[model samples]
Target: MPFKTKILFLCTGNSCRSQMAEGFARALRSGDMEAYSAGVVRHGMNPLAVKAMAEAGVDISGQSSKTVDDLATKEFDWIITLCGHANENCPYFPGKARRIHAGFDDPPALAKAAATEEEALAHYRRVRDEIKAFVQGFDINAAG
Candidate 1:
């Protein structure tokens, strides 16, 4: 059988955006693609990300934060960076990996800036839904 495409989503923190993207991609692509996420630093999975993904009907409660070093040996068909700073800082991944950047504002940072928890969750929901829509349309194989 042909190998399923492997995709790695990346962010600086591995907390919010990359995790959410992994959840979204799993929901949309399922067996068609293998989705993984990692960060430059292991900042732990963000609670807001879990909550936001739950609202989207995709449970990411089991995913953990991973560092780039942890994933150094794996080869991905695509490397998608979800934050602007991360996109700039991302190192080259060997193999035929096609790198793509789709930067989004950090929802956790927005939540921190908000006074109410409800307001923070609202921001996360918006970001989660937006990223879901964006990733749904990506054609990783064609981009290479």
Candidate 2:
């Protein structure tokens, strides 16, 4: 059997976009790929991110916020940037890991000052759907 792909989804903050991409990657790839999300700087997992994942039938409620420093020793087959800031500031990783940029808008930033909770959640939901589409369309074999 072919080895399962391992991926790390990164963003500036481990709050919304990366978290959503992680959830969507897991939901879409399941046993085919192991996906993790982390940030350049640590921030608590966004509540709306969890809610959005839950709505998509993926439970990311227990996933903790992790920093790139925290995962420095781990290796991944692919390191995917989920935001432009992350892509710009992405650190070098030792190993044969390849890098890819798949930028997404910061849903938490959009949600933070929204006039209503519904508006915030809706933004998160839309971001979550976009992540789902990206993950589902990713061709693992193209990683090489």
Top candidate when judged by TM-score against the true structure: 1
Q: What tens digits encode model 2's per-residue C-alpha lDDT throughout 1-144?
A: 757888999999888888888888887797688888899998898888898789889998988899998888889999999889899999999998899998888887888889998989988988888889999988877945
Alpha-carbon shift of residue 127 in model 1 (angstroms) = 0.7
Q: Can you give the TM-score per candidate against the true fold?
A: 0.94, 0.93
- State model 2's lDDT: 0.87
Question: Model 2 RMSD to the real structure?
Answer: 1.4
lDDT (CA) per prediction: 0.89, 0.87
Cα deviation in Å at residue 4, candidate 2?
Answer: 0.8
Taking every candidate in turn, the Cα RMSD to the unseen true structure, in Å, is 1.2, 1.4
Candidate 2 wrong stretches, greater than 4 Å: none
Clashing pairs in 2: none
